[model samples]
Target chain A: MDIVCDKRAGGTLLQVNGRMDAVYAPAFEKECLLVIDGGEIKVVVDLTGLEYISSAGLRSILVSAKKAKVKGCSIQFCGVSGMVEEVFKISGLFTLFSIVPTVEEAFAA
Target chain B: MMKPQGIAFRLASLTLLVSTIILAIIVGYNYSVSRKIIVALAEDRGTLLAKSTAKKISTAFMTVQKVIDSVAFSLEDDRLTEKRVNELGQRVLINNPEIFGSAIAFEPFSFQHDNQYYAPYHYRLDGGPIVFARLGSDDYQYFYMDWYQLPRELERPIWTEPYFDKGGGYELMTTYTVPFYRNRDGQKVLQGVVTADISISWVQKLISSLSSREAEYVFLLSRYGTFIAHPNANLVMNETVFTAAESLEYPQLREVGRRMVAGETGVVELNDLPMTGDSFLYFSPLPDQHWSVGFVCSKKEMLAEVSRLNREVATLGGLGFVALALLITFLAKRITHPLRELTVSANDMASGNLEARLPEATTKDEVGELTHSFQAMRESIKNYIENLTETTAAKERIESELRIAHDIQMGILPKLFPAFPEHREFDIYASIEPAKEVGGDLYDFFFVDENNFCFLVGDVSGKGVPAAFFMAVTKTLLKVVAESRLEPGEILAKVNDDLAEDNKSCMFVTLFLAIIDIRTGVVRYASAGHNPPLLLPKNKDAEWIPPLNELVAGIMEGTQYTTKSMTMHPGDTLFIYTDGVTEAMDKMNNLYSEDQLMVVTNQCLGKSAEQLVDSVDKSLKKFTGGAEQSDDITMLAMQYLGKGSKQEGDDRWI
Candidate 1:
């Protein structure tokens, strides 16, 4: 898995790609906490290039969201589709965090 | 055994070789230069001796000639008598001891008118009394002798060649003869001859005394090259220099003899002379006698001191070379001692003794640095091995514990087959297989009442020990809620609320819970974000129950669940499973997807619940083709027989 972080007008953009399973899930969580800890009040995680996500991946995202909430940092997810969208709906992560269809929509929200 | 040719040996040998060559050059040069100097000095000494001896002989001859000239002047009177001539000759001999004899003879009948033989000689015999003899008889014809005849013809005073005078002196001698003349009527007439003879014994003594060394000898050669005085007494007057050169077959000696006879004075090397191996000859002519004196010096005797000096120098140089070689070897060994010790220590280390003692680094050099590095390397390797051993032990302990946890989790599931055999109304079988030592997947079945049998299959989010614990908690809460005889939806709602309370980790389980009434063939089930179960009727294709879009349990609090009812005919089976079946992957990462799961389940339509679960598992294994199972797999199947269906031995169903 790979994560590319970029500074945008709306927030810090974290573009996540590759399989987010048990092995690589910790990397995504660490990336999210790194942006939040760096005083980023708004962060957007783009999963447009994500191929697969396991339950462990959902757990890491939930853990990162909770840490971001405590720091008063908002983390938004964009490009939730395919197997990742199905997992998000079943795990009730859709009701817990803000999600959008694209990176621009995530930034606007 | 031969020792190793190490640096010390090589260094010492090189030093010895170089110094030996330099010593040889120095000694050889010294020997050659000194030999040259000695030869030159010997030549000068020989020339000086020859010249001085010749000068002394000339002075002695001049004194004897003066005495003889005085006797002849006295005999030149016109009124002289024979008795007066005898007295005059005797007087001259007595006055000069160097003159051995004196003679006065009248020219045949010139001294008297009738006297044909008239000569008188006076000589001393071996420094004895002077004896007078008349030498005018037939036995001793003094007028015909060279001394008398040569003066009459030449009319001048002259010295004869050295000879053994048998008739007069009877000894080896040479004579100086002078002719006297008388004036008669203003014309000069030859009166007689007057002569003085000198023995050559004194000349031999003088030549012998000129030599300063034992190997040096002096010789006197006459005008005809005869040996007048020589080191060998027999060769004197018997052998000339030319005869000795011929007998020895020495051309160079013959050339020296020729030069001396020609009155030339010089020094030459007498290499061809017999007995005298190498020598130098210096020859010079006497000023008065036309004779040459030669001084011979042996070259070996002259340079004996130089040879001794060279021997001593070579001995001392050899001793010094040995000492230098020893010192070099000692110093070289001292320098390499540390390296030898290092080799031993390195060998010990290579043989697996990490704690081998290293040589102390006394000097701050490369060897010292190498020793320090080796020590550091040993310590690092030791620490690395210690850390690896400790980590392996800890990991083994955790793995053993995980195995135990897996056993406990498996014990909680309903594994026994033929459940509720006395009722004969339904058959249930469930199995849970964890992907790891302990997993989050679980299945349970139990009688909630006499008529109501409740069963559930759940998948906790994430895996391993944490999920396993969450699954256990969900199963316990689910059992408690289901025993209250509430609907399946109510039991799910109550269990979800309990699990969601203070759930800080956001952990949840996807569950499909159901309650079946055995007599009525009525089933009421609810799913909390779980995969819908498949309904398989006997001799009919399998179909999936419609799923509710409800969130998985244990995520949000107070989430309501709705129960859906399905009536099962006799010989109908209901199958439930976690996503481990559908999401299983092959080596190519292709999923054993839901479509494949449906196809395999449809094929196993008439199989018992236990057989159905086994067939699905086999199909999954076949589809994955040895790829690692990424999650826990839990499967539960139930078949309802209905109220009227009774067991007829082994042929009740199927």
Candidate 2:
């Protein structure tokens, strides 16, 4: 998995690619936590190229979201589609955090 | 024929070579030095002998000259008669035994007028009685003889070359002659000659007696280089030193001969003489006779004693070297003996024999220290192996216990088929395969009342024993809460509150719980962050039952859950599964996504629930193609049949 972080006017944009299964899930969580620890009040995670996710990946997302909530930081996800969209809907993660269709939409929100 | 390859052999051989060279140098040097000293001493002795012999011969000649001089002085008397001359000659002969004869010869008509040759002679034979005779007859003219004529011409006394006197003395002799003069009217005129004769036999005997050693000999040379007395009698008086040198092809001997005749006295080495091999010649001249004496000593005979002594010392040194080589080899072997034994023991240990016997370290040396260290190493290895064996056995026991736990977990899953046999309105089948010996995936079904059947499928956050325990608690709480005959969402809410009360580990389970009303074919279900189930209509395609918006159970307390209802026709089927089904990975790490699940479920629209579950399991296995199941795969399929739709010959439900 690869994660590319970009600084934006409103938040830090983190673009993640490849698998987010049990093996690579921790990398995404670490990227999210790093952006939050760098004093960014908002984080936008772009998973447009993410192809698959496991239950372990969902747990990492939940843990990251909880940590961000405790630190008064907000984390948003964008580019959810296909299997990733189905997983987010089933796990009720759509209700837990703000999700948009693009990085620009996340910044506008 | 293979040479010795041991260090002992090499050490001994090296020592022998070095010592042999050193001993050879010492013995050789000693032999050469002693040889020089012995040769020098022989030369000195020879020189001394030649000088002494020359002095003795000189003294004898001086005595003969004194006698001859006194006789000639008396012959100068003016009134001397032949009788007086004969008396003078006899007196000279009787007084000197070495002289064989004496003669007094006058000038022609000078002594007696009538006779032309006139002389008188007196002599003796081998110390016998003295005999008197006339020395000058017609056949023996004294004036023409070398003894008389040399003194007349030179006007001085002289010794003549040796010759045989036939008529006068009848012996081989050399004469010493002196001239007498008369003072006639103030002019000195030669009157006659007087002589004393010495036999050459007496001189030869004297010269031959001077030699002391067996290989040593002496020779006498005349002033003209003639061999007067020599070891070879044939050469005496016959061959001169130059003729002998020519016959022998010895130029060095000829050189020495020249020096001798020139009255030179010294020692020289004669190396070119074939008869003498190598020799030293000591020559000296007789002072009065002008004769030379030579002493020849062979160098080989001179150094014989020194050579023998050197041979004995070398032999002893050889014997000592042999003994030293043997001693060195024995000492080297003794030192390396323990090392050889250690090699054998180490080989045994290398071949997996930890109990190989080690040689005792008796001495406090390097080999001994190595042996001690080896024994210590062996002991440590043995202890380490023992500890390793014990740890492995403990791990095996834990593995076996996990197998039993897996069995118990499977046993609690309601595995009996044809469950609720008397009720033929629905058919359900479920299976759970853990990725490990135990897993956290579970599926359970139980009737909360005679008209209500509740079923649940759940997956904990992770795998293994902790997840399995959480799964069990969730299943039990769902069963307990369902017994209260509440709605699906109310039951899930109560169970989640009970689970989150002590969930410090933050572990949670995704659960889908539902109750089917067999009388009306109405299904009410709630999902606690679980995957949505696929619904397969008897005559249409498969579609998912949209999931509720709720967090997974055991994450937080007081989390409310909402229930959704669905009406199923007589041949419709519902399939629920954990993410282990859809997220199952192939060797390429590609997931068996929900799209494949939807296609396979549509194909199983008219199949029984058991057939549908088996088809999906086989499809997953085929897609994975021996890839390791990285998660637990739990699947449940239920097909509802309207009331009174039981088929004939399907008495499996009876």
Candidate 3:
């Protein structure tokens, strides 16, 4: 799994690609924690290229969300579809957070 | 003198010799026969090719002849005069690409209005337009030329010998001439000659493309043996086959020319032809021309196909012979592989390795049968030996195990009587006596800290080696946990969790674990489904303590056990033992229960810890009444007298 981050006008755009299984979940969580700790308040996760995600990956995202909320930072998601969307729906994360069609729309919202 | 290796080498050599000799004879014979057949086939092919070429040349001559006749007939027309003859000649030259040029020449005073001996010629120059010129030059006279004189003499059409018309047609060419005369008072008088020129290059192109080999070629020869349209440009119109015969002093070359120029059509093999070397020649004559077309190919070139085939055949034959020899060697080994294996196996079996096996043989031949027989023999012998070995091994194993288990169990017990003889504050004793070859009953007591004494008695779930192994694990776990200085309950909990993890065998132990404070006489004990101790007080009754309601150790993970404490006065004893003592069955099947153990403990009131434990063991032995002990019997007794001073030396009691 790859986590690529770049700064945008509205926030930091974090593009995640490849399968976010249990193996890569820790690194993803660590990077997320580092980003939130660094005070980058607004973040948009672009998951358009994400192939699959397991429960461990979702747990990492939840941890990131909670930590970001406590730090007064925010995270939005975009390009949610395929197996990643299926995992979100099954894990009830679909209605739990913000999601949009594109990175631009995600930040705009 | 012939060993196995020697015989193989002999066989290979003999086979190679025979194969090489036979291959040489066959290749030699095949080469001779194929050479003869190929040469014969080439002769037929050459004769057919020459005949076809002769037909083509004849057609070209007839075309030129027709054109000359056409020009001669046109001269008889009154509308055509000497003035317009050049124009007609130019038209004839331009109409046929095959014709190099054409011309019409008249005699002197033939036409009264024309100049005497006037002639006009039109011919192509290096692929340009037809060039017109008068033939009246003093240096070259047209009337004296053979093309003019011959037809004038014969008063007929004739083809001239092919020549390099350098100054006339400007090419190597042949000319066809037709003479025309005008009737003078019914007496025909000679007028002039009409000539049509054809480039020999057209015939040369047809002949050169016919042969493929460099040494094989076709050429044209005139009636007088002059070279015409030969593949060798130097020989065309320059040297003849007769001249070559004369130069090389080989008369066969002239004979070949005679054979062609006589209008003969046949294939001739001349072995000593000059310039041509040994060659095959075929000739045929052309119509309306005194010329013969012949095809010649060197004998070496004709037999080149046979030589190539001979080399290929020899190579293939040798390769095939080598392949056959290798296959024979491989097949011999295949037939003998089983026998070789059997030899090795028998040797190994003699050397006392019973695991040696016969190689499998799928063939039903003698070797295969021998292999199967050997397999059966080996199996039976191996089985008989193994059976005897297993019986002896079982007995020895049991005896050794009993000896080892007895030694280990006794070694682990606290054999020393006044276990704390130097301290004088307490006395402890322990022993384990197994009923069978091996047992799992255990008892241990050690000082954990300066003020605390750790004690434990355990019986693993089963008997024999498995139970003994679990007992060892439990003892070690308890000892390690006790060193943490935790409470009895916490220590037992930690030991239980550690042992329960990865306890796939599901073996468990019932233990009474305790920590005693010597200075305070306070005893805190935790029990895991064990028989409680009999507490003996001074001047009071000895009684059995109630059991702790806890599961056995190693049964589960994270099981919590609670501790129970009791304050003891001085001169009190806690006697701990497994059910092996209380449940001991006599010859009459009557068990010595808890009440009996309490009574026996009370009877040893004034004894030391070692004496108390010894007395209990003696009672249990007597109660069994000579029957084999049913289970492992283990016991531990600790007596708390008074707190002895730290400086006191109590070596007298040991």
Model 3 residue B98 lDDT score: 74
Worst 10 residues of 1 chain B by lDDT: B644-653
Model 1 achieves a DockQ score of 0.53
lDDT tens readout by residue for model 1, A11-108: 89999998998889989988888889998999999998898888788878877887888899998999999988877776556767799889988887
Candidate 2: segments with Cα more than 4 A from true spot: A1-109, B1-19, B78-80, B100-109, B113-149, B160-175, B192-200, B272-276, B308-654
Candidate 3 deviant stretches above 4 angstroms: A1-109, B1-7, B164-167, B201-203, B209-215, B270-278, B298-305, B330-654
Clashing residue pairs for model 3: B108-B117
Worst 10 residues of 3 chain B by lDDT: B645-654
DockQ metric for all predictions:
0.53, 0.42, 0.01
Interface RMSD of each: 2.0, 1.7, 20.0
Residue B644's C-alpha lDDT in candidate 3? Answer: 68
lDDT of 2 by residue, B230-297 (tens): 87878888888999999988888889999999998899998845557788889999755678988887
lDDT of 1 by residue, B1-654 (tens): 113576666777788889999999999998999888877777777788778777777778888888888878988887777778888888887788888888888777888789887888899977689998877877777777887787789878888889788876898988888898888889989888888888888667656665567337888899899999987888899998899888878878889999999998899987746557788888899856779988787777778888998899899998998898878878878767777788798899889887889899887888788878878888997898799889999999999999898888888776667767787788788877889999998888899999888888999988999998998999889888899999988988999999989988878888999899988989999988888788998789898888676878887788988899989988899999998888888999888877888899888877788889999999999988888889888889998877756754136555
Sort candidate 1 into its docking category: medium
lDDT of 2: 0.84
True contacts kept of each: 0.54, 0.59, 0.00
Error of 3 at B341 (Å): 14
